[model samples]
Target: FDQNPLAQMVVVGIKAGIGERNSNLSGNPQDVLKSISDRHKLEPTGEPSLQNSIKMVRDSME
Candidate 1:
């Protein structure tokens, strides 16, 4: 298995649905969202749907 896992992760993350409003979650929002999405076993969808929004807020505590 000589696949580039990290590169794949980045690709999946960028396609996760990030937008302007979501473009400010952090100074490095793009990167942060990626981390968040990965943690939830998601594809880095930065849209933060009803479900992910709730999860993101909850995860912030930890």
Candidate 2:
């Protein structure tokens, strides 16, 4: 679960694995995740990455 304001903007804070895509967004969640991951030096695996998770959570608090 991501908490970054950018992640919220990335996917509008929607939970994953629901089959439904993020609300009020363009393209797919995979695309969003990949971009987010790439920006944070993650592997863009589409699944949760430890680095991305930490970055997102930490970024959100600021």
Model 2: per-residue lDDT, tens digit, 1-62? Answer: 24443443344221231122233343455667765554565223344345555565466558
Measured with C-alpha atoms, the lDDT of residue 61 in candidate 2 is 51
Model 1 poorest ten-residue lDDT run: 6-15
Among all candidates shown, the one with the greatest TM-score: 2
Question: Residue 27's C-alpha lDDT in candidate 2?
Answer: 44
Please tell me which predicted candidate would have the highest lDDT against the true structure. Answer: 2
Question: Could you tell me the lDDT of residue 26 within candidate 1?
Answer: 38
Candidate 2: global Cα-lDDT? Answer: 0.43
lDDT of every predicted structure (CA atoms): 0.41, 0.43
**Weakest lDDT window of 10 consecutive positions for candidate 2:** 12-21
With a 3 Å backbone cut-off (N, CA, C), the pairs that clash in candidate 2 are: none
